[model samples]
Target: MNAPLDGVVVLDLTRALSGPYCTMLLADLGADVIKVESPAGDSSRRTGPFPQDDAEHLYGGYFQSVNRNKRSVVVDFRSPEGIAAVRRLAAGADVLIENFRAGVMDRMGLSYESLQRDNPRLVYGALRGFGDPRTGASPHVDRPAFDVVVQAMGGLMGITGPPHLPTKVGPGIGDLFPASLLAVGVLAALTDRERTGRGRFVDVAMYDAIVSLCERVVYQHSYNQAVPTGDGNDHPLLCPFGLYRTADGWVTIAAPRDHQWQALAKTLGRPGLGDDPRFATNNARVVVRDQVRAVIEDWTSALPTAEVVDALSAQVPCGPVNSAADIYADPHLRIRDMLVELEQPGSADPVTVAGQPIKFAGAETRAYRRAPLLGEHTAEVLGADAPPTTDR
Candidate 1:
């Protein structure tokens, strides 16, 4: 069966997490992605969490997670011959993606404007800390940024944890979210190119993406002139919509609506609380959130985590605070094929990585190919007689 993007070709010049993640999504959707790397290869090859028994440690798990389903070709861009080869590849590709600092591509003479001379219909996508100068430039355009930097500067950390204690999220949404948005922009640009026969420049900034993700705080600060503070696990807008303690562990319950609240109250053997004026409506409950929380915890404290979930499962939206181990053992994940096993190079055991989240009705859902070895496809792609030093 043909995939959604079977005929589209992508020249991927991204390293690290953000750029690679964007290309990975395209590759998963059946785009012919050719990962262009330097002679030293992607820096992620050295990043770890290596297997215990693997002596070679060829590629670490971090690299494997986001780089599957793509071919790698090494090119020494410092040389004229290498630069010529890259231009040739870009001429045939439908899309090109990069995550370098703002001016690095221009310095290397591989800027979108230069490449468009060869392929006018090519869609160019860039993910950066601030943004590319082709779009709108910022004073901090030259500064380097990572996931944590944007999370803090974009207002996510300010409202994440307990009061007075800012916390970074466990996952690196700072990088991944921007990459996801860039993928959308690339697709949109590709669609527009088909209509106009002209490609466009698309860029996403990590800071801008995180700020968009935290838009609630933006509206609150603008409308009420109030600075939002952390309220631990509870939500500011909805009561009974946060983590709760059970006898053995933690569970989350969201009973903000009237029917759900009434069902929860009855399930806890306190149906009268549903009608009590102090806690009857969501607004009233928010005014006395402490009392509402205490009342719920008093009943849940006497029950184990499983019992609490079982009792409220049909009545309210509730689930346990799962750890990694719990998630690995979850039957729902197995049924949905969310955990995929892949054979890593030089390792006898298979490594498990996350599966693609987006699903299509008839399309294959998993990455069929594994991440490539450094420059493994270099000679085949550049032609066998190209140059010896070109295929590091």
Candidate 2:
């Protein structure tokens, strides 16, 4: 079935996560995304914590996670012929995405200015570290950044963990966050083009995107002069909003609303505690959060996490903290089609991967194809009309 972006052509010059992820979303919606890789290939292909059976092709789980529904073209960007080929491809493309460091595209003569000169209506998207051309020079411009650096620098790590230690999230949200933001910019540009018949240049810096993610901390710092400290699974402003140990495992309970707090107190058979001077109001409960949590834990620890979750959910608000295994076994996830399986190129059987999160009623957004092998579509993308290649 033809999807929303059926005829849109994207020249993907991005590597690793951010740019590829942006293009992947477009590809999933039926855009023809042609990923242009260097001779060495995307570094993520080799850097993965891979599955045990196949190690030769660098077909790691990490690379597969974000690059489905697109074709790849391995090109030596340094080669004159290859650069010419890319220019030719860009001429007919609707979007061009890249995550090279500041000035890398300009140095290679493939900047937005150069590409737009050839294709005036092309949507140019760039993903960068702290030092984008728009942000001028940064000390870390030359420094290679991963999710960790962006999280640490963008104040995410500063407020992420407990008061004693700052921790980064397990997933590579730094790259993916910017990727999502860049996707928004690309779509917005496309929408604007619909009105004006002109595409626009867009950029998403990892630092800036992470900053947007943690604007609450910035607001507290600015307005309240509060240097936020991590609350160790508990919310600083909300009482009894944290993980509590159950007989079998852990569960999360949150009662921000006064009505919910009253409901929780009644559910725990401690209704009088809700009206107590130190825990009567949300503000009071927040001030004496530890005492309130201790009282709730006393009631919760007697039951298993699932039992506690069931009891609390029936009365107020609570949920069991599910492990990865628990998540995989979850009936709701299966029912919603959140987990899907696809066969890897050259693999014997299908392997489980994440499915598209959005479900537009009229859109055909199925993951019909698997992630492409490196240079798998070099010939197909350039068209069967072009010259054939013997190179593997």
Candidate 3:
């Protein structure tokens, strides 16, 4: 069956994570995405964790994670002919995405105003470290930002981890979050274009996106003037919500509601503790969290994680904190098809990768193509049935 974005065509002038991730979302929905890169290639191509025998191929695991289901075209936009080619490609595209620094596109004569003149129905998606130029410069705008930088500058680092030492999240939360917002903007603009026959600019900033993710901190600060402090192993507002050591491994227990907390107390053979003034309510429990956790840990520390899981399943909400090995061996993941196996393009054995998170009842969800080698589709993308691949 045809997918939702079957007829959509995207001109991807993005490199690295954020832009590529946005296009990949469109491609997964069956859009035809053509990624345009410089002749020197995306810097990510040179990133490590290369394949066994194909060190020459510019295919790094980092690049592959975000670039699947797209064709690639390498063109030197610094040249007059190259600028003309990109404009030609943009003329026929449903969407045009770029993540270059401020003024770079306008300098090359390929800004939204210029491109929209040719393709008025094109959704122009642009992303940067901060809000668009229309907004005044931010303290961190001129300096480059990755996930860690946003985490630090956008208040994520202050609240995460222990009180004395702040820690950044391990993943590319900054890049991925903005990419998700950009994807939503692109789709919204596409929907609007269908009705109005007019395209618009979709801009997203990494800092803004990160701040949105950390909004709960703002809520606490605003409501209580509490100046939220770090809670290393417990929930700030809820009781009995933290990791506990089991006989074999670790497990997390979250008894957020009053009923669940009472039930957890009963399951541990200490129902009377719930009546104690110090542990009577969630707010009070937070004050005596160490005493409450000590009691729960005393129960969990003797049992295996599975036993604890089974007992908690019958009593309250609880689950084991899975490791990579545990997740790989999980039956639930297989049943839900959260992990998928695909045939590798150049290797004999199939490669298993994380599947799409968004599931639709009737729509098929799968990767359309493997990640492209650098300029893998240069000839095909710039070939006949198309205009000359140059501009300026």
Pick by lDDT: which candidate is best?
1
Per-residue error for 183 in candidate 1, Å, reads 0.8
Worst 10 residues of 3 by lDDT: 383-392
- Per-model TM-score, in order, reads 0.96, 0.93, 0.92
Candidate 1 segments whose C-alpha is farther than 4 A from its true place? 364-367, 384-392
Candidate 1 on 65-175: residue-level lDDT in tens? 999889999888787777788889999999999999998988888888899998999999999999987788888899999999999999999999998799999999999
What are the per-residue Cα lDDT tens digits for candidate 3 across 94-150? 999999876789999998899999999989998888856745566656667677888
Clashing residue pair totals per candidate (backbone < 3 A)? 0, 0, 8
- What C-alpha lDDT, on a 0 to 100 scale, does residue 78 get in candidate 3? 77
lDDT of 2 by residue, 122-217 (tens): 998988887466546666776678888999888888887889588898788898898998988999999999998888888888988899998888
**Candidate 3 structure lDDT:** 0.82
* Alpha-carbon deviation at 46 in model 1, angstroms: 0.5
lDDT for 245 (candidate 3): 89
